[model samples]
Target: MSVTSAATGSGPSRWRAGLGRLAAGAALITAVASLPWLSGNDPALTVLRARSADQDPTPEQLTAVREQLGLDEGPFAHLAHWLGGLPRGDAGTSWVSGDAVLPQVTGAFAVSLTLMLGALAVTVAVAALACVRTLYLGSRRRLQRGRGAIGVAVLAALPKFLLASLLATVYGVWLGWLPSSGWQGPASMVLPSLALGVPSGAVIGGLLQQSLPAAFNEPWARTWHAYGFARGRVARHALRRALAGVLPQLLPTVVGLVGGAVAVEKIFNVPGLGRLALDAAIAQDLPPLQTATLSLILLGVAAGLLIQALRRALLGPALRDGALPALHAPAAARGRFTRWVVAVCALALLAVITAGLLRDPLHVDTAARLLPPSAAHPLGTDALGRDLLARLGHGASRTVALALVVTAVCALTGLLLGMTAQIGAGLTEVVSTMPAVLAGLLTTAVTGPSAWGAALAVCLVGWTPYAAQAAALLEQERASGHMLASLSFGAGPGYLLRHHLLPAVLPGVLRNALLRLPTTVLVLASLGFLGLGEQPPTAEWGRLLSENQPYVELAPWTVLGPACALVLLSVLALNGADAVAVRRRPASARTRPWSRGTGLRVKSGVSAG
Candidate 1:
């Protein structure tokens, strides 16, 4: 048999792997050490330099000042010099605060890390509980499944930002259960964490609910039962088996939460990494922006990689031992006509929703000379003569485009990196959990408050999630017996992925990206409202809200119009995603393909001979 050949012969490959790891480590270290010089041109530093320069006595003194800061050196020279100094444990001084930049950034990171961890903890706990209930509440009955699906649909359809805002307003603003608009102590973390975690938890819940039922009903689960295993043991083993399916989807969910937490940071005035990113971006500080972006990327990559590794460990031996079998054939063909009807109905509803925003009917007193909702001007005119409806259509298009851009960029990068095997589990973990606020801060600092710049920043920070998720799926597939089937037929890694792995993982990736679209749009809008995206006269939804804040008392429609559009569009996109998942159920779950006694026995006390 060629079994040993597939599993053995690795000296050269091991050496090559070692070399690659060394190279990656060196590059990351070099990037970290030189970040100060790279990000030194930030507006804050420029102002600091100018201030320091003005106080100088002579040309010699000015030159000396430049020399002292290594401003005279070229960027490469400066980076090298900084890298050289880092081995001695010196990260240099911040031009703004005259403090060590490393320590300050690290301290800021510590605060942000704590917040991220807390939020992640909350999400995991909440999601686990929700998923467990959805899975075990009913005995695999059709009605229970329908209710669970409906719950997921409702949760998925709501926008995270709108959810957070509403929760903040109701729980914090009205009830005063938690402080709103600022961070103080641990108490401040509760509301934002809930707001961020709930939507994320719901996402996890949906995936688990979908995966668990099939996993439990599989032959393996039946085998465990046949062995006289307890229900608890069967449930645990089934969940563990199902988790292989769930982990890949989680990478993006966590990253999305990172983005949401950024908005929460701003709302609550939390000085976490998300806030740092926001501040940096708003101030156009390039150095901070660069640092923040790199940090976020690394964190996200590391997180993703870790998750992938866990999936590999769980799914690997089964593949090597020829236990897990390859799936054959596509899923059942859904009703084409029904799908078309649903799509058409959705489009029609979208049109009606657009008209409601555009056309408004209200009474206006002629003597007041005030514009009320009327046929001549629907939704009324904003402070400017521009129709709210026209602006909204443009805004919706822009929002959707930006969301798609972020999703596309992230997805493509992830696929490329995953295919190339460049982004491993360790890298994803280090990169994906990055503080959204920090990325926003750094980007605004460098890019000078433009939407394109924000989009770029979002892409840079967001790519890790998709990459991590894709890489995890890739590793899981490779560790399954399925990869061996491809190899046995003489398929190369690339061919195997394209023909097998890609098809398996693409559905989950696309579903996740679509689900995340609304949230990304809301993030862009929040940044815009905070004066971090488009400058005035650009007419962005966020910018519109900010401009009309004062007039909110007299006429809230200006602010409400864009807000409604944002909320509605976000909800519509999420609904579409749930619909897609429901329509195209995968083959593995539908047919129960795995043999009862053949696949590796889960640790369910279910003996298989």
Candidate 2:
């Protein structure tokens, strides 16, 4: 069945509808792309050009320049010309360099693509493992779910640039296990990828928690038990069905990550597109900027389309099947999936922590320090040199650590503030309206660029979202039967919250937290780019780009690499979260067959424990 049929439950005109949507999307892209050339004479673009130019030319010269750039053509003709150029694989020329735009874009695109693909691979693998184990195998679902929820909250709240800086500090500065900067070889890829992946993992873990419980209630999932299907089979089926709904939501994440890549490339000194984009932005080079932006938009579209395809493949048939009938499965079997998910997550967490602690020892060589990019140093050396590879190894450790720490702090702080405000209405009223952007900027300005200061700023700015979500969750609980139940049991406020309120609000807490990571990462990376991260000579994706700011015009590769890395990391994390969230979301289903038919075997021993 096609998407249209699935959505409308109509006849065979579905394909036509799909085609129409695709056409509309393409039309939008075409129109947007042509705007710069067609409206090149617009006051804003003209003013910007004048401001950037070294010398003020006469109105005649400015008009001539604009006309030569296609401003003389009518909007329709200009758009048509631009459209015609696309068929010849032309992205046009750079206004600044006078070089063919396509070649430069192609080279940078290759490196950026490599970094994104690699980082995405790591993100998907780590997130899948964390989610499956956390949801299916842990001993205490409540505890694991709670911790995972908090982790998501924290990761979402902290900034990505901050995460990158901390990792550099711990692994590069303290341990000295890896090279400090430059993306010349395989060694340079490590820290950036890790920095990109950790926050993503936290996000995926939390999304799984939210979406999985909902899946538990789906009709097909319930029906599987009636067919005596294995627990794993049932779960796999449910998750597949859920992913259909989640992946589209993740598209923005992919776009954001690509944006962050600029900083990640800079910090670790990887020569990817992100770094190039940063340089272009700073230097106001229209060619590279256009290339970077276009590439990012394309990536976003691709990721979005991929998600849609997956959804069609999995969800189309399921929706056609309509609501499923319930099945009676053994309690042991019913709980098996949950057990496995929990166990896997626990083991994975242990492995990661262990790897961080026992990975390797540092071996520095003062003689090899500060090498430039060349045949001897393909990626070149950082300010301190020390073999870029070694710095990366240690840098990975530090980046991962920072992501984790920031995530943890953000979660704890957000939760506390949220819960406190929920109990204290006056505080909630005041804090709820405070804007995150303002708060973040103010905090950064006040604290400067140290790791602690950044983290504090992020946490403070990020608290508002958590507080809002929690306050709403608490208000809902305040009116529910559970509130009366706790009061009747003589449970004190703390006891009631611990026993009842927390569990009810757990799902939303998890969802919001996971959703926050990519945003935090973007903010942090931008700040770093603006020189608000760990102090100088310290390699961060943003800082790396900053160091190479001078050469962006000549050597775009330096900035492109790290910027791409940053973007990929954020996208993967967000995508993973979206996938998990979709998989775990509720499907239309009636109650379990047995529960509905008898409601007898499961005694109400405790409403909630």
Candidate 3:
């Protein structure tokens, strides 16, 4: 066998190995499916509570409901019966409504599928246009590139919920160009579609901006020009060659789109699968939850399979031609200057957030309307005469707190759930398996779009990536001869985690936490923007945008201030993390500071060579 084939354990062997892993995942999901029975709370009781018109369920009523539910048959027997029926298209009924799970799921799926399709279309259209614009108009033009960067950064950093609200506010409420939030009319789809598609569009656009430009700059481009080909013709040919290369990189964004749909549907009141799942979860309706869970699994698996197929086809061309150079080295750090810029931005963010907390953000001054920066209001006054400075401060506090809370939740959850075996992995898969946008939607369903809901949602969605890192480190450490001997001698999870795992895992865990903060902040601001966060009369960065958007023509500063602050904080968080990570990199490892698994090489709690 060729060395490459041998190294890969290629073809049939690889397939069999992958099948084994797939089966293992299926088995794990099946086991987790049984968790409904394991919970101490009775499904019958929950049903009775949901259905009962009375304030409370009597013991007699509970007993009768249990009898009807066949709960007396023992949990294991009930589970077995439920499992048996699953194959025949019978997923039981809603614990509260007596509706069959299959029908409800099907109905919800139709709506969600439509929305997903629309979102996919929007993503493709926008991304293609963005690519065309960048490739044709912006590649050789620094001004165009810089302008595109600003828009992409803004889109990328804004919270989904916030973006939804802005779309609604301007197009729906202000100009009446479209419906803001609903699924009732065709107009309604525009806002949510844009909201869901824009983020992914930004990602694909950025990748294209990188890939196409690099491809055009290749040595052969000079040869093509030497042969007297037009610049446009050369660019067109280069783009065609680069398409396969960019699509493979875009697969992750496609998958990310699925996750993002969950949140967008909720915000826009689209009666999709995510909304249905959220409803089922809130009602503790197990059948719908099970069906939804399974469907999501299938969706995720399908996306993965699609990506694999695409990669198998197109990846070869890109690989053989070395088309991933732009992908790998698009923006290498510029050394010390980059670090200094990031540090300054971070310090500025800290100062702004801290200063915002010292005063009451809600204190409004009607007399100060449209006031510019003065002795009293550093950020000036809005049309409402609300102190932008105070609001920005309080908003800063809330935004900072939101990020901190999310980071903590993700760190703890990842460490606890992902680092352990079956139980941990299953739990991790279940929670971290949720995309950020979906998590936010589910949180809103549970927490009712309040600030608390946004926080909890961020906490739920942010943890798994880091957790998987910890788990991988644990497995790697355990495989060492000494550790293997210790494990065989009965060293437990706690000992393994503390003695072997921590040294290698701690730095990465900390770095992931820092890296995730900016994302958490974006989500928080988005929730607020959607009106699911803190309600009006409260100053928030996103809320500031929503409030000041109406006065954009009259007093541009109102919209400009909040928008600037939001962008500033996001930029600072990202750069600060990069700078700090750079400061800690070992001499032997000259890779990007933010790259995943870099911390996996930590030696004695420090990044290793």
Candidate 4:
């Protein structure tokens, strides 16, 4: 096909995709904007309580407030009115403050955008460093690679809230090196930015670390080296190729960083969009919450579009050649050391669960309250004199079980949707933009706060990533030579799918789920910390952290036990993922079409294809 003709032919498809995204965004905005109606909360009463908590408004007062806020209209009419005003820069007036929602949302979004940008910069720097180290330093030793993978896993597994808390405690409270709370200046930005950025950086960096090595070993890279290309030049070129493989993940990671900023913003008291959304949800401030949700959706769409453009630009010639390198799991050695580490983490987790099951977590002794660790109470006592050890142990079951259930459901749902291509890309993008915390808030508004509600909230958006991954993997698999040959041989769809697609896609999807297990656990813990999960007097890890956080200084053990348990759980999940990835590596390496020994061979007078 001629270049101009091909471009013309692709125009309609591109336009259709853009329209689809726009429609998806509009639908998502409308759904989220309907939360006020869905929750069955009286807007006037909510606004009244938020505005003047001490005053008891009479029926006349309620009617007056409703009329003033235009709440007399039906939900659909109200939505139409809000949507109508949005384009003109009016986002309706906040029920609580009686101010325009646009300004409030924009101001908060600007703060959030700044934070997100700073965090993105951090992520890029980390990824670049990892790529450079892997490419130039030739750190291909299995032991070094395994250690690097493990370190990244640990860092990636740290929950935003826990990391924020630790940063505040050590840097802000203890060392006094940086301001812990508020957004005063660059100094204040350090802690929150690091808290938000580091885990994401670890994730992005790990992906680059894995990809760069594979790229370096590609036939093109080796051929370039043989042609007497400078080592640095070859490595730099390889970096670009490796990055193309990692670009698909960049959108989700970027969106996730913004979504995750909710907890970090709450912990650090940053006046960002996330914090605003959380506060509005808690107060049933629909106008502001709706605006925030809409803003987040738009951001996700924009990021996705931008990342797509960048990928195209990066793979300019390669796009035509269809020579993009596939990303593989890092080839970390599954040595005794790795096994030992995994074993220890597993044993510790098992012990915690078993010990917790046998203990009385609910037993509280006021007389023994705030006691330090001893033989009687090994993990010390909380303010209510509940044994920390007992609580940690018992909470393990609730937290771990719930996390497992959520992860399993998400993985299964994602796998089915992704494999079947049941979910549209636009819809997946829209749903992925909604943070777990925001989803939990919406669920809480509808069902009230409960563990079930929290789990439901997570399930709502948790499947998007897995679905996206699986769909992408399936698409790649279908485009492979073997699948094409099977189709050419008159193999039926059922046969090809049963004998080829399922076997090829299942392992990767499962591995993606295992990697996501820690994140699921963290999300549930975050909801509990925010009171959207298990109610008070219930032993849950997140609830424990929240309950004991205030008394952390006075009785460090109260918080330490649960905190350590969470960290340990994250480590275990990551190690398990590593093991799974490594186990599948050898098979993938042997089957991979483009290896170092057999590089792409461009024919004369034709393109790189």
Per-candidate RMSD vs. true structure? 7.3, 14.4, 9.6, 5.2
For model 2, how does the per-residue alpha-carbon lDDT over 294-351 read when each residue is reduced to its tens digit? 6654564456446545655665544444321111111112234434544554454344
lDDT of each: 0.55, 0.48, 0.58, 0.71
- TM-score for all models, in order of appearance: 0.72, 0.50, 0.64, 0.87
Q: How many backbone clashes does candidate 3 have?
A: 3
Over the stretch 11-55, how does candidate 1's per-residue lDDT look in tens digits? 453344345444554554444334444455533345345445443
User: lDDT of candidate 1 vs native?
Assistant: 0.55
Worst 10 residues of 2 by lDDT: 585-594
Q: How close is candidate 1 to the true structure, as a TM-score?
A: 0.72
Q: In terms of TM-score, which candidate is strongest?
A: 4
Q: Answer with 1 or 4, whichever has the higher TM-score.
A: 4
- Write the residue-wise lDDT of candidate 4 on 1-609 in tens digits: 222222222555455556656776777667666677778888778778888894678999899988887777856787788888888988888888878899888988888888888888888876665455567644232223445556666777776787788889889999999998898888877888788788778767766665565566555665776787788787777677666656656777778777657778887888998888888877778788888888888888888667757866765755444333234444554557767777787898788667767779889899999999898888889999988888888877778788889989988887786664423555667777888888887788789999999999999888877776665555444544454444445656676666556765565566667666767777787888888888989888878877777676577788777766765776676666655654543222333222223443221111111
Q: Any runs in candidate 3 off by more than 4 Å, and if so which?
A: 1-42, 71-80, 129-145, 173-177, 180-187, 210-263, 317-327, 330-351, 361-433, 436-517, 524-564, 573-609
Of the two candidates 3 and 4, the one with more favorable lDDT, higher being better, is 4
